[model samples]
Target: MIEVENLTKKYGDARGINDVTFTVEKGEVLGFLGPNGAGKTTTMRILTCFMPATSGKAKIAGFDVFEDSLEVRKRIGYLPESVPLYTDMQVPVYLEFVAGLKGVDRRDVKRRVSHVMDDCALNAVSKKYIGELSKGYRQRVGLAQALINDPEVLILDEPTIGLDPRQIIEIRSLIKSLGGRRTVILSTHILPEVSMICQRVVIINEGRLVAVDTPQNLTAQLQRSQQILIRVGGPEKEVLSEVGKINGVSRVSVKENGADNINAYLIELKKDMVDAGKDIPPVIVRKNWSLHEMRPVGMSLEDIFIKLVTEEKIN
Candidate 1:
């Protein structure tokens, strides 16, 4: 479990982060999202005890990050954006070195190194020097080092950055598998990463927390009007006219025309209108039009992220 309250970090005249606060429940995977220069890394650094905040409080597994840095570090595994690695060391050797640094017992060091290497899919390159490995493998090595200690919390900063599509998927899957067993804080600007891997999102902009919620809840909160997409088999003008007359219908426009006289219409309902699902189908039946399909349109995480960030900037 983690808790942060009014965390602020300043760099002279500029603020790294100001009054940012959120929490990650035990075994919860939280996404730390923000655009470039939005203090995402700054926040992570403070939480990891890599740097100190200008003001406020942060705790990891009940230990204050500032006052109990060592205890906090003991319970956390961190993979920073730029992983610090010994390029000349072999993969297994590198991890073994990290295990010692994390204070793993001498007798357990070998086992821990082997276990993490296997977990990270680095056994094939166990003997290969880190510098000789590809970027993807190098990242795996970084992750292995982070896990060598088997910390209760995992703090990952841009874990998938600069990887090819295939590598990214591989890394994403690995991270996803770690959820529910370890409380994870995944920091990245990638929308798909959050949507696919994180259970909740904390959006930061210009060093301030803008939104914190599950993606579905955030989408619902941001939607002012409801949108419904309906496919009707009938004359376009007649179907549109009939649907537009519904009580809450505000606007209707053709979305697509199918081959057999079926057309898809996008209907926008008035704000706070919650009865489109109940109201639309009966209206279509009354008009004698075949209602092929009807579904509510939900905003994508990208849309929500952009909207939240834009609104934060405007305010």
Candidate 2:
């Protein structure tokens, strides 16, 4: 539902985003990830029509973000990082006002406001002034306004900022539930949140598109070997020596020494090696050692993000 090609933005000499190209499929929830000053918010603003890119093109729901901004805005809801809210207005009143601004039918404004309030769990604070609400509640109010129009696309920038743990989970669940119904571009520094809620991720760094793929796929692409963590009740040195000799085991190191002679070892196998979990157990048993746990460990999303962002510096 959204397409951006070679989009570039600049504030004079400082480039916001350069040659950043990606597409968000209809009904897809895409995570936009980057470190601070990585142009994530800049890209979102261009896509949401909050700002124009200096060059290149962005289209939302088939309408050009620059040429048909009004039509594009009509089909998308945006919750910026710093929500622009009327502190003087009551929760429901503020939402109702936004609903009207989004061109919701007057007859359905009340119903839309009520529905979004419930969806955002803001019904209890419906009568409370936004200025009086807590930070978390105000963030919810921002989200409520975004959904008031039931737009086909939602561009949420740090939608969970300032939310408590419970509120974070509630908001995550709400965003996840919207996956197949609305095209969402979620920008946040929280890596795990993206892993849980986003179908795919677009990672940018230093104003350039670094990588874009499913988390699982990215892990596979970046992983050069299989890492297995195993806990065994045996002499650490002997177990390490024996495991190191096992076929397909390229390297082994003691991760931790536990009480009662139990130890955790991290084993690294060659990329083409046989399954370490299956091969290492029988060896441990024959050696009269207790096999407590064996599991393959893959690179996490955070690891992938770090690698993608730092690979250039390292190289």
Candidate 3:
């Protein structure tokens, strides 16, 4: 549904997007991740045909974004990072205007507007002026207009930004519902949003493509060490020495509670050495150490994102 090849966009001496290349398959929800000023908006603009790339090529729904931009525009639904709306117009009114602007069939305007209003949960505020609506409702109105033409590919830039929790949940669910049939490219800085709604994530840092994979795969790739948090009631020095002596335990460090009666530690193991986990737990138990808690450290999307972004900065 989307294809980009060696895409480059530069403004004077500054880089907007640099040598970026990736694709999004039909029926896939691709989450675009990057820090602020990371060229995400620049890339989205190029994909939506709002602006042409300085070099390289992009196609949406089989239509070239530059050469065949008209067809691409007809096939793509774009909700920009900062949604543009006619604040004085009512929900249905604005949608009706956009439908005509997008050249939807004259007779189908009413039907299309109604369908999008219903789909985006804007029916209750259908007659309300956009300026009178809350940010969440205003966002819905923006989303409703994007769907008025029923474009095949949806390019959403921070669709859930500034929404309340309930509204965020509603929008997230709405994006999930649209994924398979819509070929969604969701852009945002929120990691959980990517993890929850995207089937796959494309992480970009400093205008460069850093990684692209399923959420599970990205997290797994960043988890190089099998880390565990352990708390034991014993002399802190003795505990550290014993943990260091454990076979396959490559590194051990006390993370907390050094002055207190109990010591807490974070253990890093040699690659693929977690199978020796059994030996450590057993040794602690048999050595008269009182175990309070032992839990596997969880990897979050934020952790993976930070690690990737930091690595990019270093290189």
What tens digits encode model 2's per-residue C-alpha lDDT throughout 146-214? 899999999999898888999999999999999899999999989999989998999999899999998
- Cα lDDT of candidate 1 equals 0.90
RMSD of 1: 1.8
Question: Which candidate wins on lDDT?
Answer: 2
Error of 1 at 241 (Å): 3.2
- Candidate 2 lDDT: 0.91
TM-score against native, each model = 0.94, 0.93, 0.94
lDDT by residue for model 3 over 162-211, one digit each (tens)? 99999999999998999888899989999999999999999998789999
Against the correct fold, how does model 1 do in TM-score? Answer: 0.94
Compose the digit string of candidate 1's lDDT tens values, residues 2-78: 99999999999987999999999998899999999999999999999999988999999999999999999988999
Q: Candidate 3 — which residues are off by over 4 angstroms?
A: 258-260
The CA lDDT at 162 in model 2 is 80
RMSD of each: 1.8, 1.9, 1.8
How far out, in Å, is residue 249 in model 2?
1.9
